[model samples]
Target: MKRDAKNLTNAAALAVFWLAGLTTVVVLGAVIGYVLVNGVGEIGLEFIFTNPHGVNAEGGIWPTIVATLYVTGLAMLIVTPVAVLAAVYLAEYAVQGRLVRTIRFAADTLASVPSIVMGLFGLALFVESMGFGFSVISGALALSFLMLPIVMRTTEEAIRAVPKYIRWGSYGLGASKWQTVSRVVLPAAASRIITGIILSAGRAVGETAVVIFTMGTMINLPVLPTDPGRSMTVHLYQLAMEGINMPAAFGTALLLMAMVLAFNLSARWLLRRNRRMQG
Candidate 1:
């Protein structure tokens, strides 16, 4: 009787897990399919590859695309090194105690802060106080803050997940601590680190409020880091909300989605290649 009861409970738990996973897939599929259907028609050489025209800015999304790339690229570049170093220090060097706990707690709290709140903070610190004005640099600084905690946390986890036997082998080979970390551990964790970066970038690329608050809505190609520019998310929001161009809005959103999906797929491919090579 007890055996039969255990089997029944296990079956029920399995069913619930399967149902939850299926629901997630269905919802994501539906959203992606709907966006592709609505915006696929507007994607073309001219629409994607040209710049805005006239006072109302009706043309292509070239400037916004450029701006989006600038912000995402710059933000990632700014945070990736520091995040890796910080994670390495915490995970590999630091003795676990109150200080490590406090550091982790601070990062977790920063990560939980709302993006809009971060935007406001950026507006005051970078845009106003620092006199950077509304530009790619200001937006990138704000977005970097958002990405740092996530990247650092993931990197630490990845480093910790490395097999202890591997570390032991490195020590047996007479490698110094720094040499072991730089040559073996970091290389091992590289795939996971890249994955974290890609995930943070995916979220940052579509950040509208931060862009609007820090980077001005200038519908032109950003020639310099200090030049004010508009991102694709802000463009989509204005087009949809202001009723300037609904179709363009859909197209812009679709393109943003596609860019993210493509990057994710590419990252997966790279990871697979690395794994196969290692094998």
Candidate 2:
């Protein structure tokens, strides 16, 4: 009777798991299908290449597209090295004590802070305090702040996932601590580290509040990092909220989705290639 009860419970759990997974898949498929169906008709070379006239009513999202790329690229450039190094220190070198615990707690706390709050902080620190005055650099810095905690946590977890035996073997081979970490462990954890970076990139791309607070709503191509600009997300919000152009907003949304999808797919393909080569 006990064995039969256990079997029934297991079956019930398996059914629940399948139901949850199917629900998630169905919801995601529905969203993507809706966006594509609504926006595909508006996507064209001219729509993509031309500059917007009067708040995205007459032309393409060329300027906002460029600004989005600029902000995301700059944020990644600033955050990647710092987060990776911090993760390495925490995972490989830090002593297990109050300092490490505090740092970890801080990262978790920062990760949970709302993006709107981060935008406010960015406005105060980067725009007002630093006198950056609504520019690409200010927006990028804000995004870096938003992405840093996520990247750091993921990288630390990835680094910790590397087997201790690998480190011991490297030490046995007379490799220094730095050598073992950089040459052996980091390589082993490269895939996960890249995945973290991809996640950070996605967040940077989609962020609206922080970008608006720092970057401003200048719907023009930025010639320099100091130039005020609008990203795709910012443009989409402006279009939808201000009732300027809904069709163009949908088109921009589709483009943003496509860009993110392309990036993820490309990164995955590269990771697979690297793994096959390593194998």
- Which of the numbered candidates is closest to the native, going by highest lDDT? 1
Please list all clashing residue pairs in model 1, or write none if there are none.
Answer: none
lDDT score for residue 207 of model 2: 90
Per-model TM-score versus the true fold:
0.90, 0.89
List the candidate 2 regions with Cα displacement exceeding 4 Å. Answer: 1-22, 270-279
Clashes (N, CA, C under 3 Å) per candidate: 0, 0
Cα-based lDDT for every prediction: 0.92, 0.91
Residue pairs in collision within model 2: none
For candidate 2, the 10 contiguous residues with the lowest summed lDDT are 52-61
TM-score of 1: 0.90
Residue 2 shift from truth in candidate 2, angstroms: 16
Displacement of the residue 217 alpha carbon in candidate 2, Å: 0.7
